[model samples]
Target: MDPKSVRYISECFVQPQYAPEESKQPFYLSPWDLAMFSVHYIQKGLLFTKPPPADEQENFIGGLLDRLKSSLSLTLVHFYPLSGRLSTRKEENPPTYLVFVDCNNSPGAKFIHAALDMTVSDILSPTYVPVVVQSFFDHDRALNHDGHTRPLLSIQVTELIDGVFIGCSLNHAIGDGTSFWNFFKAWSEIFQAHGNEACISQPPVHKRWFPDGYGPIINLPFTHQDEFVIRYEAPQLIERIFHFTSESIAKIKARANSEYNTKKISSFQSLSALVWRSITRVRRLPPETTTSCRLAINNRSRMEPPLSPDYFGNAIQTVRGIATAGELQEHDLGWAAWKLHEAVLNHTDKKVRGFVDEWLQSPFIYQLGQFFDPLSVMMGSSPRFNKYGNEFGLGKAVALRSGYANKFDGKVSSYPGREGGGSIDLEVCLPEASMHALESDGEFMASVSSSN
Candidate 1:
């Protein structure tokens, strides 16, 4: 194999002899389950300022692989009574297959571009190995007519543009976005530590324990109670970057507070409200038309004991808020802000937890699909300062954006300090016409640019 060719690995686990009895209902892995599952699928693409001399490139990859082999292990959890059990947590032992690929012949930029087009389904097939290769291309050459530059992951080479893009398409049912990032951060930390003299210990691991008797249940809506539930399809969501100053965000927050007669409004509240209003305007839906927005609120605190960073499972719960399209548009920004904030707060309350626990415990878990449809808009806020400066030691990232989650129709994320000094960078994905309508609205534009 060419030293620079990508390598692929696959691994599998057999069911454990002694396991818990499986439940007779369908079960979904939490966010933590997804994160732990991802640790086994780590693929790092390191871009150098310039490619090393030909003699050194082979040695580099070999060394990296050796390091990885020594540092990782797989664990499996099993639940038995295999048939007709919906709530059964089956065995989840990590597989033994590990595959690698090399695209030394192609430029790194080209390789990454090609990889992006490969979806999760394509990557996980039994026929193809989990690795790929391509050459890196010049950043300027990839720009669209609109002057927006694509975020390319490239490996820099001297004679030719040599870059490597590495990816692992994980199952979404196992975890949410926050859980995914956490795993990536941990992987990065481990990779960096291998090259340094300082020893960095692995993140702590949590046992495979679920809430007591927390099997699947269903809830019902009067009108749709009898309908058979179908799998929800992930909507086509796009990602775009928006630049705003800290000052602009502050001004908007202040205005929101004044309008609502509330003591304060957060930056997230202000921006989300503006986006909500802008979306309604562009959709040309009346203010009174019913629409719902869902915000992903991290539920790390809600567990009886907080989950550790190394816990390696999904640890998020979403909170939903509903309003008429007109209510969001005609009301002052503060009103929307307050409602969004309250929706989040309400989910965290003990009563809410009790309610969710009861609902999940009841026969209603299986029927939840019949009663509630997924939200129209999905918005998330990354931990502010951590996103922009993700310096895997190559200097700060020039751009940061969220990945497209398969389930949401519209998605938005906030990145801090892209425009300098506490300013937030926004990324939104919607129909092109909707975007155009938002750009032309004066109040919407001003609110986004204002810093309270």
Candidate 2:
């Protein structure tokens, strides 16, 4: 429960003037972007020390608004596609949509300011981090796959008793996790530099790439025109951030590799296996049922010549590892981890090319493993994304979080733990019943620590 909620103050439109060079233009949506239409926004942010005295707070916030607005516009001059909307042709067999970055017509990103009574710890330290994270977002409209007329990005600033929260909500169709962070990093540089254009390290490359013969995947029996609306019922789910120290991770890796009789087991695979096995056991799923785990893989390096790290678009695809509940229950942790390792190993250049070729032929390939699949779980986001390192004038973030939309059952995202020694923190969301059961499951609780 959000024992306390963020008080909505005021909201305003932050329209960064799209550079004049960029006229009305349409950016193509890659199959990768299309597949991300229904998922939650890539909500990430940093917590900073509270504002100065009231007079200073006003000056601080006003100065921030000015710098953010102008710097963002300058940022958009380079990453213009982000300042536009998704235009769709519903008449097409399987509705086609193109990203529009028309500066004149686009309503630049939305910005809002709000406040809450709780400090950072109030939100970060809970067994299930509270859903109040969403109170910080002005998620203007429903989320959907079709490229509709909606702001491509939204930013929110929230004041706490002793800290500030900067939340960014970017449309999933425009980019993947890497692209999302890249935009933030670039924008932050400009803001911290006091709007110095010279501060931008690498201007983003907004052009999207795809193989020839690319077309939308039509008639996805599953691709109904689904609209994602936010409905808040009393909390029926749990959201918990669990930290596993380097020592624990090392032990898990050792056990996994020893069990596999090889040094091939990776930290990710070992951790995923541990989490999957733990959650599966605590949930007490039927043994005969088959379950799957989905891993979001970045395809940038997998491409033949490799896409530039600066390629700012959705460059990710999901890889799935599956087994029977019986197998997961019966296998040793290493065996379970091996399954995940094998999936990672399967992501070869050839395999990635085949995927791109397949997407070229079929546009609507969505790997939304069964939504809330009782027998399945997924691990997204990379531990490599050091969210806590993102900073403005304020010090490094004391904590970071995903939006409250993360309450979907069986969904988990991993972040690089702030301790900096190859540690891992997981934001795990599961059903209310399963989460309660998880709290009491000794094995699952054995390695989890309260780092926030």
Candidate 3:
């Protein structure tokens, strides 16, 4: 059966086993957190094959969900923010508002058990990502700000015919990809420990990071919800995961370095250049038209004092490498890669602070087309995340997939290949016609491996 024909078995809230006394106070969202209010939740999931036997499948699923819920409850003891909801305060002078997470009366994270009549191959075998994959996640259209009324964290464990898909929708306002994965790893650790919380190597540092003289509570200029709550309707596009082997990435990096006469060109820069150039060539835009590749930088280590790696909440800034369509097509891959390298290297601590200062001076929400226009690309979700290391006792995940939230033209998500060893999977989203063109482009397809 189609994946959309999913049957939801049960829904329940899994609260923390022990709520700390400090959690009674509202958790103030920093400027970094507020900046993500308009963005969608981080919808990522893992795929696993080899489910229990058909005869014992019902009991197996029930026991699995119960264990997951119990482990999640234990995990939330430290990640209590996930159980909180967004709250607002009406400020009078200057007519603005304040947003914070009211952690006092915790509603807990939503745990949903669902089943779909599909196999693991139904998802991994497709050239283009299946549209029905969106159904595996809860809060399909929710923004990070929706945490006010909706659950901040929602997980859907969907049982397939021969596999299981663990899909999670975490409000972006609460954290970034780093925090999301940290929470996931910790939860899996607790689960694998069989309720032994001592297995957690390092508890997350929930203390939010803030620059000196900045704030624990940031104020926004929007007086009305409509001014900040903008809906994102993605354009007609197709998403395809292009797998690049470790050897291919090295070759691309080598080619870029050879042309540039420098070994400083990183693999990521080379890959970004290749895609940017390839897409520009296929688009055939006017000579003077400008194209950009927006790269999201993790600011944890980039800060002056350096934030804790486990510091929960958003600490990211986007840097764009802009070039004319003709310039990209006319120049060599090394040239484009150099442009991206300069952009990344120049985003120092001063630049990161400058970005926050500028945003603070004039607060605004990010729209879907804000940085990722049809002619521009936005690269997010790094390949360095522990995609396959997440072991839930069922063995490593077969694949990593994301949901429909925040997907737009020119949006590209990077993941580590299943085989690891520096391999990468680029989940590229482009307009239907452009995707067709990309598939037929031999030069681009040459680096992509046959297997995903």
Candidate 4:
């Protein structure tokens, strides 16, 4: 790691405003709420990067931290109505805790990995109120080893990769993915332009913004009846990338659209449809089983005047499309595409916003789980892939992959710049056998080769 670089590490914490026993009411955190929290956490990861110089690192990190500390001050407040049961507030504000990890004693990679492992464990098992911030220097001899071999993020210096991997393990009760990424991008731009007097102007905050109702609220109907409650059950999904050129994607979209006699479909829509069909074919679930597809949507625009991209808050919502197993089995790809699009459109309405508000105001809010399983397909689109720009004053990044692992039953993401082109990069998580089968298929094989 460059000695001149300074690392910025931070974590977010949720302070339970009300104790459950005092209220004597059943309160639960919804999966959507958990997702909202996730957005903030993920953004933390995105905003972090290696500073330019060893000497400037500390200053950069310190300045960025100071800015964030000030901006997040509103979120740090005591609770009201302390006797009520703990539930998510429409305006639940959580504090973002930050600490600087010292990498002086070990290689940066090792230090980061150790820090991440420690941080994740700590967040998973908080024992105190408001969550204390922990900071430390790595003193282990393991720093002498090859840092690249480790799973942690690291910086290489003098053929010896020694640096810190600034990380955070935030509680999943604050924001979802979109919210997280927005905050991250803001942080990155903030740090990058640190010391530039004009850049010091803080972005506007929109607390009243919420997710537009574009997708089906699958959990709503179930939660209302007091039947099967949705819980966070980590699905068995894996994330992997499938490379394809813009031309190939265009061909696929054209082919599908021609067959269905529909308007042009987006890369995301087409790929999502493909994966949805493929997963159904592989799972062979019972004919009676109902499968739903859900997608995460950004709600920054839903707010009045729009939430600033740099607004360090959760600004995401999810939409779902459901169909019976029989429908999926009998419907063509066009049908699936239409359904998915419909779901997307439905969630974008003002009425959906009302639904979220009503749901939050429900009596059985706490009974809901932090995670929801929707036949579990996860997809993140258009991850900026200007790898050539990541030259770091060196050459372009030879390869880049979002370090996202598929933890659900179905996961797919479309990234940019595959093999250096304007093509849409795809990562699909399916059974290894299914991947192999797709690879063996002549058309798929041809597409893959052409993409390369």
Number of the top candidate by TM-score? 3
Assess candidate 1 and give its lDDT: 0.42
Q: For model 2, state the Cα shift of residue 394 in Å.
A: 1.1
* Tens digits of per-residue lDDT for model 1, 369-427: 23234334556655343544333433444434222222234566555654467777666
Q: Could you tell me the lDDT of residue 97 within candidate 2? A: 36
RMSD of each: 12.5, 3.5, 1.5, 13.1
Which run of 10 residues does model 2 get worst, by summed lDDT? Answer: 215-224
Best-to-worst ranking by lDDT = 3, 2, 1, 4
Whole-model Cα lDDT of every candidate shown, in order: 0.42, 0.72, 0.87, 0.40
Highest lDDT, which number? 3
TM agreement with the true structure for every prediction:
0.60, 0.89, 0.97, 0.55
lDDT of 1 at 201: 40
Off by over 4 Å in 3: 1-4, 51-57
Tell me how candidate 2 scores on lDDT. 0.72
Estimate, for each residue in 95-175, the C-alpha lDDT of model 4 and write its tens digit. Answer: 221111112222211112222222222322322100111222221111111121221122111111222223332222333
Order of quality (TM-score): 3, 2, 1, 4
lDDT of model 3 at residue 82? 94
Our model 2 lands, by Cα RMSD against the true structure, at 3.5
Whichever of 1 and 4 has more lDDT, that candidate is 1
